[model samples]
Target: AEIGKGFLLPSASISSKTKEQMPAIPKEIERAEEEGVKILYLTLPTEITGKNGRVNGLKCVPLVLDEIDAEGRRKPLPISASEFLLK
Candidate 1:
């Protein structure tokens, strides 16, 4: 998140179990209709326009959810984020 801000880009972090975890998702995505986010780092499944070369119509950057299991082992879980591509 800081990386974007360091570049002087507006960035926001949202939490969700899925795409509809909150009512604000749609509204946030709606901003895409105008001067919206150039890129989306989604932790959950969300809809995309599929306009660019973005694989599976998902966000550009995929985040890893590092979690600990019952055995107290480290695990890297992918939260369904896809490859980042631009047209």
Candidate 2:
């Protein structure tokens, strides 16, 4: 009960997760930028989103797509389940 409550609070749940990413995340983002991999969306279609817009359920891999440009520059694109899975 309390565990689920935390998700609805004043964004505390996200703060801790963000803190854990730390300085490493900035560098990782930079590297990803070079690799043409950009993070477009924050959630996946596989997860169920509640009325409050919070994703509820277990998640395995992140559903990001690698739609790089002809020059190989990664363009951050939105994703769908069937579209991604089929590819």
Candidate 3:
């Protein structure tokens, strides 16, 4: 992905004991601050949508990387825009 033209690669870390991958939300926040990103668009699962209409935390969902479409490309994950804040 380009610096500001394309999407940033998903930032995550893998657990040593359980071998489970975890999203590095703090790291992503740091990166956004460093890059001077005013608004970061995130697509977290609906399960994480918190109380008071806020989304909190991250949960890793297993994906079959080998699965592809007729174009041999991975399918895009579904996303629903819950709320939008504008200044």
How many pairs collide in each candidate, listed in order?
Answer: 0, 0, 0
lDDT of 1 by residue, 1-87 (tens): 334545554554433333443355686665642443443333443345453664433343355646767888544345453544433
Largest TM-score belongs to which candidate? 1
TM-score of each: 0.26, 0.25, 0.23
Residue runs of model 2 more than 4 Å from their true location after superposition: 1-24, 47-86
> How far out, in Å, is residue 8 in model 2?
40
Distance from true position, residue 65, model 2, in Å? 22
Among these predictions, the greatest lDDT belongs to 1
State the weakest 10-residue window (summed lDDT) of model 2: 10-19
lDDT of 1: 0.46
TM for candidate 2 is: 0.25
Winner on TM-score between 2 and 3 is 2
Tens-digit lDDT track of model 3 for 1-87: 126546553433323211123245667655754665543333232334455876555443322333478997654343333433221
If ranked by TM-score, best first, what sequence of candidates would result?
A: 1, 2, 3
